[model samples]
Target: MAEESGGHATTLGVRVEAARREAAGVTSYVLTAPDGAELPRWSPGAHVDVHLPSGTVRQYSLCGDPADRRSYRIAVLEQPAGRGGSVEVHRELRPGAAVQIGLPRSNFELVPARRYVFVAGGIGITPVLPMIRQVAASGIEWELVYGARTHGHFAFLGELAAHGDRVRTVPQDTAGVIDLDKLARGAAGAAVFCCGPAPLMDALVDAMAAAGHAGQVHLERFGPVATPVRDAAADDASGPEFVVELTRSGITVPVPRDVSVLDAVRGAGVDIPSSCEMGICGTCETTVLEGEVDHRDDLYTEAERATCGAMLVCVSRACGRKLVLDA
Candidate 1:
């Protein structure tokens, strides 16, 4: 998800113009300006941070046409066992209800490529929907492998049906899980974009790597990438504690093995606005004045890391014994 820039947060008041069931336990919402004005421009693969009336904030991908500025459409999957945001969206948000939304931002940008392959699972299809539309409109060669728990759980079938054979639906209940190996083999020279559950993404990553197409694969994740659990034995051998200097705050703190850089900064009474403390959200991003970063986040691209100027403080640590941050 995107971050609030400059630590200043602003929300636009938008009214729920329409709501309809797209699939089982999933609802599509169309939000528009109350005064019928044009909303902020957003490209494909963008998402808005929705601030629910119940005081919960959640990010939902904008799946509507990028050309449309009158309204933004997003789909929500009711997750009973997960956070309350989805629950409130499903049960409370309705037509005529007012909502606060942040500006649309995209982390998963679709770069120009010769061909594209999209793989989506469950609600993860939302981000890929608009991407497929863009690629198809450009007359570019593209295909989609969308999967869900059941046939009824798949959304946007009517919209995607016009593409015919270009789109493949795999209902896991009827068919088994999507064969990533087969897809990977077929996606030899294509740029593969995937968004789904962690396991599904992990499988795609492994498959793409095995097919020697890892560099062409791009993904969008709602949560942090899973890291291995470090036991005491692992921490003992992890290495020496690093020192982090907050340039703006003028404080130097020792980041111990047991704590993260984010926690260390907060412990020193310096507040850095953050959400999704796991490093998936770009909220806690800090400028690296000096020192290499042991990037543990999946947000930054290789080019961004090459600059060695920015790092996600939530999970990323210092590569050397000493580091400086432009807090």
Candidate 2:
């Protein structure tokens, strides 16, 4: 299969060209467009949304080189409790299989800094690995602190080890435990980018706060954190079905309590652009011209939510009588 160009149309059909096992329970798949042409270009931190057979969609980081236009490489870890996405990708997806994918997009970008410290935990290393490669190629001063339960469970261990002093593998069994305080204390001027489990991220946050380096810390959360449920009294008072107005199409669709605004809009055969239907990625964000949103996504910052102009359609719900969406 050939890769598709970025501009002809909004939807692009792709096919799995090849698949390889990278590590225990981890595999990488190369996908290309159906035209058998070179793939579209993407930046270092870009990722694509893969539509799985179970009708569940998930996001995977593009670990391959950005210059490689022939195909997009994505690594997936077979999560034990995953909602079928990763498991199906590892067990069912094969070369030549047809699938739907979103365009490359990213929110975790590498910014200019004097120095960089990358912390990767378990499979969260997917996105950071590309950044590490880019930084190393540029001869920049950077370090990677990779952590996993054991050496065998760690992905890309050999590749990371080749960097010698530039990489630190902190296997839980060998290193006892990762000490975020000691790791982040002295890195004052360096920018810290971390992607990992919630406990690891929380510890990093605390360590950075204690070291007065909160402003220098940037993080990408691969999964959603558990959020407390709203009080029963705080539920939508009317429990009314509302109308979602699509700005471009000038169409209004009915959104019921059982159906999300995304489903309602999509049912009308409108493509609003979405990936990681769990709301982990900000790909489905749309402008909100009217109505209050019951924000449920973790991707948006408090400030972004307060702007009152955009909302993530996957998990967020409407708080007002109706939502006017600019799809």
Winner by TM-score: 2
**Tens-place lDDT digits, model 2, residues 1-327:** 223435444445788899988777989898887787877678877888887877677888998888788788899999879677888888667999988777788878898888999998888888888888888889889998889888887887777887999888888988866788987797799989888888899889889999989888888887777788666566667444678888888888888877877788999988766666767798788899888888889887789789858888878878867888877
Q: After superposition, how far is residue 40 of candidate 2 from its true place, in Å?
A: 1.7
| Cα-based TM-score, every candidate | 0.86, 0.87
What are the candidates' C-alpha RMSDs? 3.3, 3.1
Off by over 4 Å in 2: 1-8, 34-36, 236-242, 247-259, 264-274
Worst 10 residues of 2 by lDDT: 1-10
State the lDDT of candidate 1 residue by residue for 148-169, as single tens digits.
9999999989999999999999
What's each prediction's clash count?
A: 0, 5
State the C-alpha lDDT per candidate: 0.87, 0.82
